[model samples]
Target chain A: MSIRIDQLPRDKFIMPGTAACPGCPLLIGLRQVMMALNGKMSLVIPAGCSSVIPGMSPATSYGVPTIHVPFASSPAVASGLVSAVRMRGNNGPVVVWAGDGASSDIGFAALSGAAARNEDLIYILADNEAYMNTGIQASGTTPWMAWTTTSPNGKTEERKEMALIMLMHKIPYVATASIAYPLDFIAKVRKASQIRGFKFIHLYAPCPPGLKFDDSYTVKIAQLAVETGIWVLWEYNQGKLTISPPSAMYKDKSKRKPLSEYMKLQGRFSKVGEDAMKIYEAKIDAYWNTILKLSELYK
Target chain B: MQETIQRQARKVLVGDHAVAEAVKLARTQVISAYPITPQTLIVERLAEMVDNKEINAKFIRVESEFAALASVYGASAGGARAFTATSSHGLFYMYEMLWWAAASRLPLVMAVVTRSLGPPWNIHDEHTDIMAIRDSGWIIGMAQNVQEALDMTLAAYKITEDSRVLLPVAVGLDGFILSHTAEVLEVPSQEVVDGWLPPRDPHIPYVIEPGGEPITMGNMVKSDAHHMLLKKMMDEAMDGAKNVIHDVFASYAKLTGRNNGDLIECVNCQNSDYVAVATGAWSGDIMKAVSDLREEGYNVGFLRIRFLRPFPEEAIMDVASRARGIIVFDRDYSTGLGGIIAAEMMGLVPQSVSFKGVIAGLAGVDVTPSEVKAAIKDFIDDAERNGPIRIRKTWLMQKMEGGKP
Candidate 1:
């Protein structure tokens, strides 16, 4: 179930010289997914950073048919496209590339409905954890104690466990991948494209401007996030959930790099107090434990 | 032509069922719907028809009204003839996507089974709901009865799919008044509908395909010029729809010999002393009142404004200029601006014509032919005594909100 390093597609469908910020993880993830799909998918994008990145009017960066939907309607709109295509006997998958804000906050109802109906779609929720496109506002999936425009003094609420929430709908495939691990994300996208029903990929994308980090540190920050057990890499294929290779070693808490090591790289965690840190760590521990339980229970 | 008549069938149906019948006859490819009161029956009939294999279409049952319209929008963009139905709050909930559909020029057809919006939670009829989206660039029309609802919906598909007017059309039928009221409906053969309304050209705006050449729809441009031109095109289309509506109505009449009306239907406006103007099912009541008044030696006329977006200015001007006065009966009020239909007439009619806006039948209050006759008589008596008034509006409610106006 692994793709060799040399076997990756040469053509990254997302052309360079677009509007993406320096070290934009969404762009990276978009390129990987497009490469995996090989530009053979109709894209349904909602309001997010990718909306602008895919190119504005007369020119497009991606060499595929893309339809920009409203902020809250990517899944439902894709459901329509899929249905129409299926009616025409064209069983090609329609992919929805959306941000955490659209999928987790404003568009949760549509997202849930699409999952429940098992609409044939590959919905990639590119999670930057905040409304980065709208200038770093807090969203439902914005992490606990993360500094965002709306959650100015550290968020009052914990971020939602969206991957687990999507899994609860019993979709055919649910996976979590980070931009730091392109091979894993590419493999997940490739696997998902073969599935018949609703398949969701929670892509962990980092934001340099939003997270108060340097442009050069984007990949390193994402790498630290995975190493520190902040973002777990796993895949729930059909009903069997298994932790992916990139995150398997971190299952043992002691092997994980120090949480402080990961936090110091970003300014979002700068003002995080000891009490907030303890709560944040506890939430991460609880989340991983729950994932472990779910993987076993489904197995 | 003879073969087309052989496919015609007659059925006793409510407005909702009639809409379903029209959609089937038009051979709609994809239908997405969410159930709302007053509009629920339309989808229910459509669902059964789809399941029973009576109609070959994809019936998508969506979670909300927003998704209902959004799905159809996507389907239309994907080169399929699509439809959706909703009412009142449902229409309001789906309101944002309606602009998307209209602006994209998707040629979608939506039936608004019109109902009064809530709190104190009412479920009956009102034009205030449908009139809310007048400026939304959609081709808007109101059906006077069940038969008109069927014919109008079929014509809506033809009108919207026309190359000159590649925009969506919303045909509104009053809540229980039309949606639930059963009447004899003459359904033209599928062959006739197919001959009249061809399948939508997928390349109008271009359809989305997997392996097809790359096309990005609705992308943000640096300049507002293209966006401005799109809105300008909508205006041109609205103007251009007048000819399409007439042409469609003419061809449809020739095929079925049932020429209901086009844009605005008038009754005896030729040198009439006064012309009563209105829309919706109450137009029938107004017409009866005009006929009664004409028999009583008063040269009065009735004019029903069919299509709202195009406004039917020329026809309205013809009737308005000939009459000594025009009494606009509106079932909808624009709140701070008096009646909606009244406001349109007030803006359009000749400056010399005496005008009065009689706002009535809001929130499902019944306005019979006698009440309409009485209102017309009151307006004539006042106009006969006084000279031509510039603009006047009167509230015709039993219990005026904070007392009489």
Candidate 2:
């Protein structure tokens, strides 16, 4: 299923003057998701950059109803909201908009539980690689050798494979998208919305302040992530897998751009040595191999 | 207004079952919970009701107590009457969401089957679990038996949903003792409960609804004064609950012909030299002890403290002022500080009235009626000899190693 740019809704659900930093990809990605949802959804946002983007009391940038839950209970809260809506005889979608720290670390138990139960809700994880809202602490999703406030000397481990983790839950839908590709992101959301059971969409969002990059490079960095094969764009519907466009071009390792093209654009990996990058490359290769194995299951 | 009294049927039920019956009668729309000992029966019963279509509600079997309460918070904010149940460590896991439910001013109900917190892993009747959250801006109440557990669960919705007191309420019942003990409970008819407590008015400004104006809930307050003001509003809501609790109790009595006497239930305090204060199922033993002492020509009375959060200061003072001394029986102890209830009562009761804090029933150790009678007799004998008991606190089951009594 593909979304046509001309068919996209013109109305903006995200109002101006949010707390988002200049050129933050999360803001851009959020706008697309909200637009696709078109004010017909209720959001459960956990503590993260997106949580603060809604602004303070008596002022919210969201044009739809939003409940800000704790850092680890977004999925659980969404579960309750879904049940409540069903009890009211309404089947409108309930969405959990959370960050990497929430989805990968503190909130993993609840998220896994909701997925295992096949809850009828859509969970969108905007992965900025670190805990950006709390001063860029190293999170479970932070890439190998990435610098964060807590991991200032570069982290010692590779990023967690959360999208693959969600796939293992064997839910109805699981997808990965990037902020640079709005059409693809919106298309996946529209697809997931049509499903009945648990659906997860992993979004690669860029943070300017936390990543130590110029605000204008948000889109460039997000795009380079996919071009370099560091962030893959794909969807898992039922058991079938399809890599989205642009990212699908990198199906062959020889066709992908050098990893340095993505790493050099952000200061987070400035101190990273060649050995770490090689290890990261190996990890990415292993990840893609697993995805290939999963893709072959439905054939 | 002329009230029409409708006949309701009574059913034999345990404390856990009674709570489930009350939650059903209140027409809770959403129930989310994780099973813990003692409290598991309540959730199981609720799940059966939801599954059998006897209760038109959503039962969410969440992963943890944190998720359970968070789900309930979400459901409540979505303009639905929500509920959950937990005990001991489960309540501790829900500590964070308890504040969220209260500060968000969502009127949800949670039944706490009181159990001992463990390192030694014991599941028995203890008040420490509920007492831990006494200041979490929630209206707290405890039941003396299965009947009160049922009645209080019904009244909790009315008190919590009242506009003046839009806070969460936890109805506590002692683990095993009351939770598993069977008794006859008057299950109020649906028509009578509906007439007494109407469906929750979904007028909360922040509730998310279709076509409703978009709003951000549980937002950050930058200013210290603003944060303090929100807490102050919670405190004021708790203070305002005194009247709301009484009004609900009166209305429930008019409907069900049962009254818990609003906050505290006192017996034979009119002409007593000393009064025994207790809560939970053990309050029955204290009342029997009071009767035993009365038969022995001792001026003893019993006061069952139902609500612990709004502290029932006035009723406590009224009872304490008339007595020469007050003996507090606490089933839970606050480490380093002694009994929590005794600590709270020390400030409220007149200093002129001698007070003694007896810590007993830790980890479900039974505080038998004879034991209670002996304790009160000792207090009375001491007061008669020394003008008032000199000891501030006593460990009821403590035995001296050297055979010193």
Candidate 3:
């Protein structure tokens, strides 16, 4: 997947002066995705921050056609849109831009069905850990020991492994990307755009207000997540698995940063004790071990 | 107007199958549905039809009713005629997408096999499911029998796809009673239907089309006035549906010699002393009761409330005001508020005319023609003996040993 930044289209699909907050990583990721599509994609966005980030009526931020559906029907809507587009002899890619809450909880059934059917769609699940648009409520994708309005004492359950779940569907393409690596994200989007079946990209996006971090630290937090091995960047294509750049380097735990170094930056994890940190570290290590086994099996 | 053509052969079909046949004739390009009791046969038959190339459509077997409707919404927005069907709990499950389809102004058609909502779990004839979504800004209609079920399903596409009324339409058929009971229905020729109801060309500016302008649909409206204005547009569209519905019905009648009036079907309402108002298949039973009472010098009339969403308020007012008393037989009950249809009628009917609500046939309980006749007799007797009866609601078919509230 050799691609240069200068080769990418210069037209800004996510127009300037949008309502997105300063340093919102999802916005940055969406802009890159739009650029990758080169304004040929039709977006189906469910109710979330992105639904509003496109501004209100009469003023849209998206340069491509968009349909904002209910919170739990993005993938289903995309399936129908793809079918209709094909019926009309238009085979353009149909994309679903949804959030963690919608993708992992409210819309899980729809996502699973689309994957099982291998519907022709590009589903991008932007994970900000919590339901940021609804004021930082704990979602299924929220990591363990993360404080949210619904999980004030910190979430007791482990975060949902959505990327692995997507792999279980055996779709044509399934990948995990981050806003911190724009090039990797763009390359994955370009790759997904070329595939013909259900493609899912689980994005690691950092929310400043929701995670109680300074706005400027959005990109830093996202980068640290990959660097610390807390968020792995990888792709699964045609039953083959390969880990991506920075996160791939952490397979040898000796090179991975301590979990506390990543947790200490966000106030949402301030209440995390040392013992909990050890448990989370062990869990992350176990996850990487499982990923390695999957890589071996798929290979 | 196209010239009237020779009618096609008639076939015996259940209400659910009739809806499927109509959908096939309507040339629905995309169909997505989950199987539920009573409504299952509709999707199953459609699926089989799609597989056999009987209907050139994509049948998506969705996981849930929410996705079923959402898939249709997406397909319709992408400039295709789309459809789905559900019953009772399935309709309730897809409640959110119901509003999504309507608010997005997607010209889609959904056939709802009306059934009783659950607690004890019963799948049979009841109107509660469709009635629950009457206020969801979609054009709603209730079919009297299998024939009307087929006709209404065909008319629904025409009504919903009208440039003036680009709202989703739900054609309600009674579960088990109409959905399962087979009746003779005139299945119009594909040529005639094709000539009458052409392919949908939605007037909405924002459709999912490749190479079209980048337009956003269903975006947030922060301003109260803007939000209210969108709602006002829905309201006005609904108001405009009255004419579209009438014209479509008239056009359908001209194409085939069958019409369920425009909105409300009146049976001998002229100079009648009392009128019995009902909907769904049971309206046939009410009409029978009206005829029996008229034979006994009761001078009774029957009005079938076809389109429930638009409410047919003016037509209802016109018919009910002329009658000395109006008896509304509701197949479903609204907890703490009596019957839903009766409640709506109370607001529309004249204050001077006597009105009574008879709640019956709940949980699939059979409201026999004899039972309907007896209820009408009671209402007529009350209106005759006691001028303008005070009892606004009566629970029919309830076994009460003593007087219990």
Candidate 4:
């Protein structure tokens, strides 16, 4: 049983006493990450729910020092703070926790510049499909058929390929992780912690409130997301690529779950008709095929 | 208490080197600035001092004005005493981080040689460049001549780093006027400057250093709450800096045998009915002009505004209240708004008193001793005969185009 995260002798975090909604995947994922990291890190958050989630005073949920920087200047502020700490001879890892809105929209310039300079920091983007903090506004990472606040009908555009964008920077480490697989997520965070240069981790955090999904369905929805090829898991490290084979490597057709299995659970995609669903499926197929070709090149 | 009789080495140095020597005496820990005209020589001398080991300091040659200020911000946050120099466009380029340094409450000191803002790109002196950042929450001070330039540089560290006044400071020198001109200055000994100004306080910076695994200094607060803190802190510091400035000036006065009492003044005014308010290198020529007018037996006095920011509003108000009329000799113009200093003084004085502006020496143009003399004479004559409104036609703008000749 591949060492269940709950069963491992991981150090307990003094953070997050308040319960996340029952089976809230993101909170669970964060708990696992914090346990793996074990209090040797600092977190930089922009204007996101994560910035607000840390509890008050002695009841603090974040076990480590967490700074909330401005939305657009997170990368710049992080770089400045990281340099300052390095000057003082501290060797601890500096981590930035950003939402897709911060990473892909407002903070893009600062992020690109920091990565280009190969700053020693880890940037984690918890992409919950849309901007959940502000009532599910369509963000750059929102899928084609998702119905968000801005995208009142169905989203007309494709989701921006953020992990691929990060890969182009030729960073030392870049990976995608999901709540469906806790061990895989923890493994990727641990891998990032070992790397020296700019490391990026894109975690698919499904929001029950924004996705209009049932609380118990978070992990199942995340699993179906990868199985349906809507969220592919991969890592790029110094010109090498590793794509995790689909949930069931043998019986490829059986591994390919219907798109409706993922979308039907969320009200965000309820407005999408059959034709729109077909369009969404085609875009996901195109994206996976490109990823497969790149993976082959690296192999 | 003991009677101390200490003499300093009197030297004939350009304004740039005087500033460099003062900064050296202050023993800054880090000097990060890009080279800009008039101001470049100051940093150049600082670099030489670093190389010669006359001062044990780290000198970082950054890529741009933006980076220069940002680098100092990093250094200052780490508890190192940092300094930088820039002029004109370079000063303008660091505009964004100027507010950052002040808001972050770093006691970083920068020397800005005031040069004219460009269209033709003349590299002569004017006050507009530094004046443009007046509201950036910095403790702004101007030097009237080389002596003040040297004295004020040391004073800057003492004022900015005071626990009560933890804000960035800008010490301004007139471009080519004070920047390039050589003058007699009693540069203080390194030991004396060290005694006057201590190292930066350790507890101020909120940003955490790396090994300590500290968090950066920030978090989301209510907008009104955050702004109120900025306002409350800034107001307290600025108000505190006024007294700190005076005490340091008193100490500096004792060391140099020059009384820099938050201001400099000359009064033919015991019998004189009119006064001129001016500052920087031009104030020297204005003094000569005041003497020439005094010879004509017109009751005239000269009040050189040594410090610009903290405006010395009370002193000017006191002087203007006694004078029959006032003439403001401004080195820079504010386009459609006329002279900035003239406007400021006008706001301070009673409506009963009259004043006119003699906008001169713009873009480093020569405001000769004779021209200042003539303008003062005309201002007095017009003010005494006519009302304050029509004191004199604004003179000296006639020769404002070219750089120093």
Candidate 5:
């Protein structure tokens, strides 16, 4: 379905001409998420490209109060910001928008702690696969068989499972979304504002620069990720499970595009063989089955 | 200097609970804490009070020491009076945000139960934990007792909220010594405590507001000029905290019928030649030891440091100029350096005075009044016969080597 600009919320979150690269998926994801969240939102960005995307000076696109904290402190900082809002009797929702590097790697300790404590806030991880801000460095979330400066011949392990780890905390809300599905992303973020206990939203954002793909392919790649069962859309809420139905790309599983297409676009995954691909497939299947079992148990 | 009036009141209360009561009296709007030994009582009391709606503040149970401080920082930056508590290991855990709170100029206040740093897994009174992050830009204060801890907590707000000194403060109290020991505390009326520290202003804007808005906080701006400008402001505020702390103590004195002075207090050194300088709870023992030595015709004095961070240099210099010998009792080691306080005192005094580094009571090691007396006698005898003890580098290094890995 072609998205209509008029159908989208008319409100502007980040003004035009911001520092985000021309086809940055995080910027697009942030714009929609902010619009859905509406007024009175505190954004805590940890150290990463998305954290610095607001720009330093002369030009800033974000229309709300955004604070960029240290790399490992986004969740902790957001928890503080949320408590401050509560202390001040402010009804505004506290939101944390962190990159995968900051959220899954350096920030894991703080993030896990905040979720376990059930701090009243919404934390969103804009996962662009790797640490795009630091020249496409491999992070814990960097998929297996993904190449990067450090992971010269593709990543050796499976991506870190962040959402499930947060789920173990029994948070009030935890959901996954992709920029390609704006409505789902917006709905989850907007709903997160109404909830009380800790809520997390993981957005699968495509990076043209980091992925070494054409700038215009950002949205298409995001769609392909979800449809390929590579980035599933699901939520764990109070031990309950809810998965968004597959999109058009998953209508025919037999004709589903190969994972190689996604890997071929990104420089981080330039090298891969049958052995590595098999391991990747097995990991994905196991993760998928685990999610299915969780859904069954919770349902 | 003379033996002064001591308001010796007896009461039994855990250190954490006492500090919590003080925090309550100060009317902190946000109370955040994570459970850690020697400091858990402080948060538990606040949490119970919050559960019963005894205090108007929100009590948030954070996951880690880092989150506890981060929550306080956020709330404080949002213009609410915020507080948190942690001990040794916890303090080390929150080191990063401790600096963040200070550098951002948030009027955040925290109580640190000084416990020995880990390795041997001991939970006892030691200054090493708090002193480890001394340069993290916090206005540091040492509490001699529960009452002092209570009073200093309010004083922290007075110093931090003062426009001239908008910096975070960490009020340190010895862990097992001050935290677990019970003592009679003259609990002031809520009305009086409220009057002493006014309600926090709610309208002040935070560095960051909700919903992706932009605010000029620790923003990355162009130019070294901007960098130095912020640093200069922070430096100026720290300089201003000295007078602000004194004034805050003065106001509290008026309300609570107590008085605290800056720099060092001279006890029994009026016509004496020797003085022992100490801080925190040990000062009481040191003073008693000095009084006994004075009765024996031994000219002895006690210099009690009221403020540790903005080290009262002028007052220290004045006291050292008069005293012939100085014995510095320090509870924290610098690891490769001498006792933290002893090293600091050495730099403050003139070379003429004999200085003895009495490094004891570390990691909650017991130091009784008699031990203080012995140290004082040794210092006086050395001063009278061989002159001032010459400075030694290897001794300082030896002190460092004693630190636990």
Candidate 6:
């Protein structure tokens, strides 16, 4: 199920040099998305790191047509774009590149509306846990015990189960991907582009600055997250839910890495106490249980 | 589009229905709206038309007023003529996106069923909602009656999509008064509107589409002057829109045999003693009041300020200069300031005119012709006797049990 680096497209849609910081996982994921779609999709982005990552005005890093919309209106905007594009008898896909804060919290209603309408567009939420663009504030999907600016002593609430919520929508596709697994995400994007419905991809992106990790360890942190079984990489296709290739071996609890190792690498979890860790671990276990249960759909 | 209906015909419809009729004629490709009071009927009718295939359009039932406007903004950017409808709270809900559309300079039209903002849940007519967007780089047109509501929808498309003025347009018709009330209006054939408003040129300026040179919008601009220049361009467009509105109105009138005036409709205000100014549903009553006052030997004339943005400043000034008195009837307020319309007129009208900005119909209570006539008579006498008087007062329908304390 894995493709070699040589199989990836040689022509890059995203030019080199952007406002993105070193070891930024968003650029990696965005690059993969553009490559997967062959840079033919119209992109709608709400306010997020991607908005600034496109470089400044007059010069854009993206080599594809893009639109910037209001913070909470990306999904609906994409729905509208698809409508207008198809009206002109063009079959090009309208893709929405949104962030966690936009998709899960502020833009939740619009996200739900687009899904309910089953709009023919792909919506990928690059979830970096918090509102990183706005100075690392707590977002709806900020993990339990994650110490964001607003959640001074670690978040008290459980992180929202957005992927599962999206899966419940029963759209043609719903996926959870990590930036560390570029081939996996690229594969999903290629698969989803062919499905004519609301396709949601919740990407597990690690932030270097926001999470206070070493800039070079961004991909390492994301990999640690998956190995700890905290960020499950899976996809719900048609009526079947299955664990993806990279994460296939890590499904067993015994094979998972130490949760402390993942938490210790990121400073966002610095304030996480023993009690908070217990709560966080419990939540992770519960998430895995549901994901594991759903994996038996086609077994 | 498949011609289901042909030829011009006279039909009596409510303001909401008239807007729906015009939208169908405009051949809007994409429609997105969320239901709100008074505004609901326009979308309801449009949805019915879409469902029945009377009009070929993609109607998206958005979740909120915010999303409703957002969809149209996206659709417009995606090279389609788009439309939406909302009311007071709904407009306010779309406040952020309104700036997005205005700044992006998307050419589109929206019908605002004018309604009072809610504190105690009032669904009646008021001008506060549309008035709040005066500075928001949108051409705001107020329709006095049902006919104007239908005509203005097409006119709005013409003005908004014009190469010179590529901005959003909001055609506001008063709630319950024009919105729910039925009246006779001429519904022109799609061919007529087609002749006036040519198909929207998808590449007038730009569009977000697939397989194009990658261009980013709404990114960081380093220069303050660059940001200010965008605002300046909007102002320049607004200033230039006066002629565009006039030409569009004249062209529309030439074809349809009905003209809802150019920018401001001068009703017998040519060298009259004083002009009574107002807009929306109340302006129709104000016109009646002017006639009533004239029959009563007052010789008062009416000036209905239709396009509130690209605010007919020169037109208002010219009329005010001719007469020594001008009383502005405002159905909307400005919080710490006086009536909204009156406040606008106070700055533009000549120093010679006895300008009185009167705040009336705050909560959409009936502002009848007789009440307006009485107020105008008093205003006329005050202007004649007191000469060049300037003041703002509320024409209260009620007061404390005892009298004005």
Per-prediction DockQ, in order? 0.75, 0.63, 0.78, 0.17, 0.50, 0.77
Error of 1 at B374 (Å): 0.9
For candidate 5 chain A, which ten residues in a row score worst on lDDT?
A246-255
Q: How many clashes in each candidate? A: 0, 0, 0, 5, 27, 0
Quote the true-contact fraction of every model.
0.61, 0.55, 0.72, 0.16, 0.53, 0.71
* Model 1 clashing residue pairs (backbone): none
The DockQ ranking, best first, is 3, 6, 1, 2, 5, 4
Specify the CAPRI tier of model 4.
incorrect
Best by lDDT: 3
- Can you list the residue pairs that collide in candidate 3? none
Indicate the worst ten consecutive residues by lDDT in candidate 1 chain B. B1-10
lDDT per residue (tens digit) for residues A1-299 in model 5: 23444676677768776568889998888888777876458677777887567766434567777776777877777776777677666778888888998888888888888888788889999998898888988988888777777888777777888888888888999989899988778878877888898998888898998877889999988887875667778877676786775542343445556776766665656677677666666665676777778889989
Error at A186, model 4, angstroms: 4.6
The CA lDDT of each predicted structure is 0.88, 0.87, 0.89, 0.75, 0.77, 0.88
For model 5, the superposed segments whose C-alpha errors exceed 4 Å read A1-7, A15-22, A57-61, A235-242, A245-252, A278-299, B1-12, B203-207, B211-213, B263-272, B392-405
Q: Over 4 Å off in model 3, which ranges?
A: B1-5, B202-205, B398-405
The residue-level lDDT of candidate 1 at A268 comes to 88
Worst 10 residues of 2 chain B by lDDT: B1-10
The reply for model 2, stretches above 4 Å from the true place, is B1-6, B388-391, B398-405
Q: Which ten residues in a row have the lowest lDDT in candidate 5 chain B?
A: B1-10
Q: What's model 2's TM-score?
A: 0.96
Task: Please say which candidate is ahead in lDDT: 2 or 5.
Answer: 2
